[model samples]
Target: MLNTGQNLRPGSQLFSSVSESNHAKGKYYLGNQQDGNLVIYPAGTIDADSSYWSTGTSNRGLLLTLSLDPNGTLWMFDGNTSFTKTLFLTNQSSGAAPAVENYYCLTLDADGVLRLYSHVFLRLEGKPTIKVAWQVPGDRCLVKGVCGPNSFCQLTMTGETSCSCLPGFEFLSTNQSTLGCWRTLPISGCVRSNNSSNEETRMMATMVEVKNTTWPENPYDALPVTTSIEDCKLLCLSDCACQISMFSDSYCSKQMVPIRYGRISGSNNTLFVKVYTYRAIQRKKIAGAGAMLISGATLVVLSLVVLSGSVFLICRHKRSLRYMRAPQLYDCKVDGDIGLQSYSFQDLDVATNGFTQELGRGAYGTVFKGVLANISKEIAVKRLEKMAEEGEREFHREVRAIARTHHRNLLHLLGFCKESMCHLLGYDYMPNGSLANILFNSDVRPSWSKRVAIALDVARGLHYLHEEIQNPIIHCDIKPENILIDRSGIAKIADFGLAKLLIGNQTNTLTGIRGTRGYLAPEWSKNTAITVKVDVYSYGIMLLEIISCKRSMELKRAGSEYNISEWAYECVMFGETKKVADDACIEEAELVRMLKVGIWCTQNMPVMRPAMKSVVMMMEGSKEVRQPPRPASFSQS
Candidate 1:
């Protein structure tokens, strides 16, 4: 009968069929279940057969069958070598009627290639029965290599491996371990020989080869380059005692003193020169002729003087009048109700042991350590270098200025020695040497508190000089080496050679460039006018060095782009304030506070920087800190 919506088939092999009838829905009936093709009415229905069947449940709706290989094995559905079933399959299949199964499951391999197998057949055995074989893609290959010294290599299987040098190199630091090697050494430019044979022979050939590798160890003794190499050689050879000459492309440098560390690298470029034979002979001839002329002239002048005594006396009187009317080289004034006492040259000579003991040597003169036997005390004897005009003026200025000044921080002058051309000033002895020695030595590092104390001491000394002293003294050159520390670690400012007294209300002095290179104030470079602010700038640099445990010049290398001050400035700007503290300092808060004061003193603009008086207060934690302006040129290089 044909129903509204129904279609069915009887038997597993299509033995009965049903179609829709005009009045009733189609129905399906089966005579018996057998192993044959079968269909059910409606799209969703159940079918059964003697050997195989399928349920219409939503979960397991679709099922399939498989035939075994022709190896005397009965036909059975393949279920093994398929899905990896553990407890569920083992327990459920064992209790229930033998589970109807079909084709095996497939899985992805390590290379992501799919593999199919027979689950029922493979599970009956101990191990998997199927095997998979496929080629691995070329992109999946691995790479291995080694990096060479000063060269870094990275492995990349997708492309070629790469090798490169570290920063600050024109090429790879070392030759490649594999292919593509390159040289790292910079190509030597043109090798132009020095024009003067004497200079080349003395500096390049003789002195540099003979002396120790390192030269000019003392920072104070560094020579400045002047004229050409030939001129340099002539200058050195002209002076019989000249020891070394430093030559550059433009000028030749000659040192009439000791070469501290003699080593020179190609990068140094400067030449070291020594005296040659020909120049020595010339100098001797010149000195002989000059001496003979002086002797003959003195004898003739004495004979003329004896013949005309009255006439000579009248001429001498007139000469004296003329000399008295001439302007003095320097003006002098005394303070503190103390009268100036001048001793003869003979008196100082005996007191200083004939100037046998040299306490220190400077650009101006030698300071001899002396003991006044008559006075029963030790004193520093400063013998000024000979001067025709300017030097004498400076000597007199130094004597008058330092003589009247009396402060705990200032070095004390006892007396003075004056003669026709010789001058000497006496001072109290400082047992411990300058601050430079203690700060740079590797053997010991001063405690954090001690460094801060030294800074405060220096500031106080400057404050007194700028404010309390009758004639305000400006310490034009204020470096660590100029600061002397006594046995008790109390710092006293010394070396008043470059000091000048303030005239009237003048805040600045017009003078030639003086003081160390790294410590000079920026204003000094542009204008001749100098103020106490120059010393303040130098003190700032010194304070930064003390806190960071580094030298300003040493920080200019392949690394350390930022100098001690710049580095501290960066830390402050980035809000990483703790980085300013030195590793040796145990007190974090104190170190930061000191660094803040240092930055304030080092501000580029003179108007922005605080005076020594304000700096002292800030160090004592009595003042608040404002943001310091950026430095003009912070580069150490």
Candidate 2:
């Protein structure tokens, strides 16, 4: 009886009291509880308590059922429904009502008891929890046909039970009075009708009318009929599907099922049982119409499938043409004297084995482990993200620089693919991945000397980008993800997709927010014109994060207690930098000096930070260093 809440759905359950589908028309549902209660409620959210109905029978063996009729009425019954309770679900101040468009379910237990539950998606527990709305006890008096047939139960003045037949009816079973009574005139000629006239058929139809009674029972069709009582009776007679018609409160319900009722002397309702001699003939006609409808629907579904398939093929062909044309814009067939080469999509697909063996995914696209056929060299293939004109300009800038720029401390771009809209870039594979992963994820920790060497190499690469080139290039994104390590554990700067080429004295690059969170420079937040100093600030943050093995972004503001940077600065000020150097195995003086230099680079004002050349000099111990003042960002605190 204990089930995960996710299994609850609209019109789904273990056992329903009625053999027919409950909540088939949607909106209403039922759930069987472990406590043996049968409940009926709306689906999707936790019980809104809008207007739910239930058979309040719990912990009573394993029999339960919660059912709903097409017309807003819900029933709670079990295998033994003689004493089961009935509830009408309508919107009111004192009841629960269902919301529109939600998943719901009803369950009947082995004991024949019924309960209703709604499906609620609450993820803190990582599964749904069932909310009970309504339940019904398997009260035996409520079971349909308990009094058997054509007979009603009566309580005598002495509190005894007795069964009696209607005026002209007789008992079907003499020994068992509850087995019900039958009509004095047997229903015949129903199967022998040979297309009789409407007048003759209506004349032969006999109505057994009983007032002050209605059964909370099964239905063949529960819908609005004419206000006139006689019209309601005639409507039931016309439809062969309907055997009995009940009218109460201005609505009519026609049913083919047996009617069961509790003894009531003053209900003021009407229940009519129509006996037609041609009922068997009408049933055959209905069955034939159903077969023809199914055949017509099948043909319509097949035609729609063919039409949709043709449209899909045409759209795919048009898409392929756009992809093929995108690569022709650049002359990719030409080879150059530059170190980098050009590749086609077909050539890369073979290299990466159809883009299999995925290394990982990034913010843009996927990276795969690949191998070149000509050189037989293992490489990393990056499928560049599709972009607009501005991004296309950036892609071209990266390609041109990779072709010309060559440095031992920089990652080598082997080639690029431009055969279609699929853009890819290939780079020499690094045995050791990024510094962040090496420091945080891997078992082999980077030694203090190795950390210092890595820092110097990264600075040299930045120095090459800032001062070495004729027109300096700004590597706007310089987080550890872009720092690749060679087989010898040498750090190399990579991922130049965010590189901006500077011409002459132009340092201002106006654009939207760029770089990742926790690593973005302060200038990005201000929307101010960016300079190489932005890279300096980012490098400073990266350097501090490397030293203490702590995150700079997680640090407190300058005056709000200790962040990694602030802690390192204060430690160095007190001649205790070695304490914050973590488990590094390096000379105390070098650790002290690196800590000082790291803190100085992260100063609030970009102008206060040193250039890449000065950073390299400070790490190499070739230049004099000065103690820094409290950072300007502290003023806010």
Candidate 3:
């Protein structure tokens, strides 16, 4: 008996002979076959071609049942309610529920489709029309056996499915191409015949290459590895039983005749079809010998033109190479901030050798050490790993901000790459490492004068970014990790991944909290507008670390002394400034002066913080260092 408009709960079984019809008396109905495939077939028929939709879950398990839950999701599961494993599911389509309580069913209509429908009971004295809620294998071509063996299926521009015969095969029926295809010539076994040897048979056959196509059939033999596509093709041609072969990523698979489930693909798979050498030659002969003669002349003319152009380009490139070989010209190109180089992702990937040497990781990506063989210059490549749209904007902004500025203290942007989904920035490599290593981890810290000079270097870089440029920029993240030391021990500011640019004459902008904690300005947490002063606060904390060689907020340091700025201020109050200086050859006067400048910069109020320009002067002793009030709310203790 067929039932309609009834919900199938968990453990409800539909046998091979059982079916549920649509409430509107449709000719088609839903049934679960004895082979364990849930299918939709028309009335009084079970032919394979007549059934266009199936769950494809044959041999799932014993005692399987199809259930449609209250949320409108239909699922097929094996076993009983207590121990069930879900095999397949379809998501709910419509948000509206059936007006009749607990009313829904899997229905098959005259259109030859299996669907889940909801009957909305009308308030008036009238019957309710059923709405199609969901259907599987929506396109007819997705149904298996639609296009039989030796043929491929594809969708036309009009969105209709079509079938085509594979190479070296002919359509079984022109009127109904879906009936599939047959090979034009039969192939013999691998056993050597009296007339031909195995090698001779291979020479008589040729492999035709087909790109962007695949057949999902399992291979009879698979080679673990092959050197190239040519090697895979040769192996397939050498085998008498192999009619089709697929090669991808060094792996080759050999398939027998009558390849099934053929379709055009966008993957990297390449299909090779074996055919007789005569047939292959016959196809090529369609172009004719006259066309080949013309093509030969055209190729000779084109080759000469290409050779002449290549000679001119080679000479021109050598001249440019000679000009750029000088250190001064190469440095000038980076320092002038004009005509920046645009590198391709492939070039950078080859330079970095697949980004094997990782230097460090940042918020968005990792930095790698690479050398450009063409220019013979070592560089650090920052490859952004975030492939989202937002990450692309940040990449472009960083490139734009650094490309427009030139300063000795600021890291130079040598080039950039924005290809496909890859984003990378190239800069001159710093062999001396970062300031964080020198301050906190190094065994031998630099002398007092050298440390002061390093502080001045960073201050000058920040000053140039905050005021010296036409459009003022804010280095939102300023910490020891960002300050890199060059071969000359000159500190250069790097990692502008978080830097923000202020529009024409705009000194401040509102933004969410950014920058490392313990270095962040008080205004950041208050949800107020941020300015260059935030960077000053961060630099102040880093400056104290530079002077004392202690982290700003060391959790390991006990007794209210973890915060370096707070502890330094207390030491200064007691006139024991020497206690704050960690270097054995500390210059007491310079330490006091630098510490005072640092204190002023870390003031709780952004208004009280000195600008980066003033900090540079104080570090160089051009401006007098005065007594700074206790850095109020800035304490990290």
Candidate 1 lDDT for residue 272: 48
- lDDT by residue for model 3 over 15-48, one digit each (tens)? 2222244344444445665445666644423434
Estimate the lDDT of model 3.
0.69
lDDT of candidate 3 at residue 429, scale 0 to 100: 97
Weakest lDDT window of 10 consecutive positions for candidate 1: 42-51
Please give the distance, in angstroms, between residue 253's alpha carbon in candidate 1 and its true position after superposition.
57
Give per-residue CA lDDT, model 2, range 394-467, as digits (tens). 55655766555666688888888754467788889887888878876777767877878888899888877765
Range of the 10 consecutive residues with the lowest summed lDDT in candidate 2: 42-51
Off by over 4 Å in 1: 1-336, 339-341, 386-398, 501-511, 557-562, 574-585, 634-637
By lDDT, the best candidate is 3
TM-score of each: 0.45, 0.46, 0.45
lDDT of each: 0.51, 0.61, 0.69
lDDT of 2: 0.61
Q: Tens digits of per-residue lDDT for model 1 on 96-196? A: 33433323332222221222333334334455444322111122211111222222344366544454432222233234342212223211111222334
Ranking of candidates on lDDT, top first: 3, 2, 1
